[model samples]
Target: MILTRRAMLIGATTTLAGCDRIGSNARFREALFSAENFHKWAQRSLMTRDAMAREFRPDQISPIFRANGTANPNTPEYKALWRGDFADWRLRVDGLVTRPLSLSLAQLHSLPHREQITRHDCVEGWSAIGQWRGVPLKTILDGAGLRSQARYIVFHCADRMGTGRPYYESIDLTDAFHPQTLLAFALNDRPLSVANGAPLRLRVERQLGYKQAKYLMRIEAVQHLSGIGAGKGGYWEDHANYDWYAGI
Candidate 1:
């Protein structure tokens, strides 16, 4: 039987609840991590490296794309940028790159862009199809000139979680260079609203919604995930035990 994305997410959620009840069980945690690794391996092995995520026609786009996670970061720094219409905001690209970059919003807009109407499957079991327009992430990576040691792309965002941790996420180079992966600045033919990650957000189409880090302030290339927040890759992955490889 084929399991839909929603079904898979629901099953994962149920399993996570069970794991929470057994939180102190080291063996159980190890088993869960092993299972997640296996799932990622199976998906990658079964599909071509550049396999494209399903995209929809413009008419199929959702009438209302509900914003996930924080609507607005509301930090003084973010608010200052918002007030200036993000003209002063810059996306820093460094860490394991031959040449670091500090790209302004206008500079990003000047780059070649791609637009796709794709479905966003959220772990919370809600999905929305929206048209996203932005520079392909590969374009940015190529410009930055990755050092040979770089294996992952880390997104640093402006939003702070309830625990006062900055929101962040990572993806392997495979996803980073995927044709559909983008540093999206516009959604549905308009500049992204603050609630929808204005100025910049990531569109790793093949992954779950949480992997699409929003309010992006920097992109860092790293050799290992160990030095990141709590060493689990992302805020949710570290604090809430969400699987790091949340591939759909």
Candidate 2:
């Protein structure tokens, strides 16, 4: 039988709650992440891969869209961008494309854009509604003439967790081109704040908040993920054994 969204999320939470135990045992760690992969595979098998997550009316916008992960990217480069109001910031998109792009915030804003009011669901068990405005990720990918061989899109972010490793995330092309996937620069009708991933952030609407990587610095389309950090496709996946395909 197909599981409800709540049921799926609850199961994920239960799995996450036991991560420490899994981490302590090498065999168990493998088993746990293996199960996470199966969870992702099962969800894809049972549900439409491109189904949109629930969107909400503007009235439902949360008064406080609590920031998840890296409120402020303390790196010198990020600090400089924040001080200059991101006037010099550019998002680099390269790899496995006929054309590469280095786009500034203004350039991104000039492109055809989309606005959506969507719910942000965190793995830590909180949800918030917010209006996000940005260009669809596919718009950028298409503009770059994404190569047919490209299988995954990786995000390199500026934020570093306490462990001092930089944040990173990846998604398969299926999610990369999803209608609701955005490279959002604005939230709630205003410029995004430092506490909320200023400059740019990802919005993979169907996934949980952690998959919505913040402080995006670069996007690379690659044929495979084996060369990326730890070959697991993301920071948390490499460090905490969080599912690489965090489909919500």
Candidate 3:
């Protein structure tokens, strides 16, 4: 019998609840991780690459968008940028591009941007709606001149996990160029707060909130995920066995 995406997500929820016990069994952990590949394949096969997530009107935006993950990165490097109001901050776009870019906050703001109100669904089973404004990731990719071989875009963020490793996430070029995918600099028409990924954050609307990497320091286009953390494509996925393909 075939399971729908909804069914799979429900199953994932149950699986996650027992994950601590599952992690204790090495064989069980390996089996679950192996199944993640099939899960990714099934999701991509069932949904079109460009299938849009539902968008809402401004009136639908949530009054208090709850901050997730790192509310405030206490690292010295991140603190310096926050202190200077990110004037010296630069978002480096490199790897598998003909023209690598190092865009400043001012330059990013000057670029063409798209604004939309969309729902953010978290793996923790919560949701919120917010207005996000930023350059469509495609615009940046185009400027960087993506090479034909480029397959995925990896977001390297400033926040570190408890283990002190930098946070990161990856999405395929299909999602990278999707209409709703953005490098958001503003939330609710205001400069992003430090608690909510100041400077810039990723908004891949079709995926879960964990995939929405925040406080981006670099964007790299690569053909493979092998060199990334644990070769699973994300920090949480590497450390906590979160599904690498976190589409909801």
Candidate 4:
């Protein structure tokens, strides 16, 4: 049944993969230009979020859950901190803010925390229910003081994609404060595995897997995405056709 559902989702995504060529129909391009229209169309054709994605009962937990992304960053800077158990790994919260913060792992955990058993829905069609513990991003943002012009929050990571200098991602303020959003440090009641973004990672629950960026090193509030690395929202969004608005 899972495989059948998976096939259907792929078939649907393929159907929407329209092309843009010289002399492309003006009407077709116009319709897609309004991203809001594309968003509605995509949601209609893809798998909607299932209730299984909610906080799961302990009995429903999965053992041997798969981890995603770089298990450990290869940078000597990261390795040296790992040897020290990340006591000095500070998360720089800068960009358009009144008072930027330099947060340590211990300082992050000192803030108010929330725990939720959310389902991780990968664009590849796998799903897992796991509990995550972290501080609300709003509390962190408010404490840092956002400028009125700051429209989005970008997460700079310590990992790289392909030959790219480093991997980075961002989201607008609305999604940043969504009740399900968190800067998670623990997964399934234990310190998160390095593969799953040890120390800290983002859990923006309403989006797809890749949007849940890992290896968080800095947080920057910005007005527009135009100046950030190729002016694209993320690596997958830039290289692959992963939609920027990946709301489920």
- How does each model score on lDDT? 0.94, 0.90, 0.92, 0.80
Off by over 4 Å in 1: 1-23
Tens digit per residue, CA lDDT, model 4, 1-248:
36687898887766655443522677765566467556746764574433123567877776755787567777888788777888989999999999999999999989999998878888888887788999878888999999999999999998887665677788888678667789999999998777898778998887788888888899999999888876777777667646677774
For residue 124, model 2's alpha carbon misses the true position, in angstroms, by: 0.8
Q: Which digits, one per residue and each the tens of the lDDT, describe model 3 over residues 1-248?
A: 99999999999998997877777798987886777688778888998988888989988999999999998888999999999999989999999999999999999999999999999999999999999999999999999999999999999999998898999999998899999999999999999999889989999998899999999999999999989888889998888878878874
2 or 4: which has the higher TM-score? 2
Q: Which pairs of residues collide in model 1? A: none
Q: Which wins on lDDT, candidate 1 or candidate 3?
A: 1
The sequence of per-residue lDDT tens digits that candidate 1 reaches over residues 1-248 is 99999999999999999878887688877876688899899999999999999999988999999998988999999999999999999999999999999999999999999999999999999999999999999998999999999999999999998999999999999999999999999999999998899989999988899999999999999999999999889989999988889885
Clashes of each: 0, 0, 0, 0
Clashes of 2: 0
Cα lDDT of model 2 by residue, 138-172, tens digit? 99999999888999999999889888989999999
TM-score of each candidate?
0.91, 0.88, 0.87, 0.81
RMSD of each: 6.7, 7.6, 7.1, 7.3
**Lowest lDDT block of 10, candidate 2:** 28-37
Clash list (residue pairs), candidate 2: none
Global Cα lDDT for candidate 4? 0.80
User: In model 4, where is the ten-residue run with the lowest total lDDT?
Assistant: 44-53
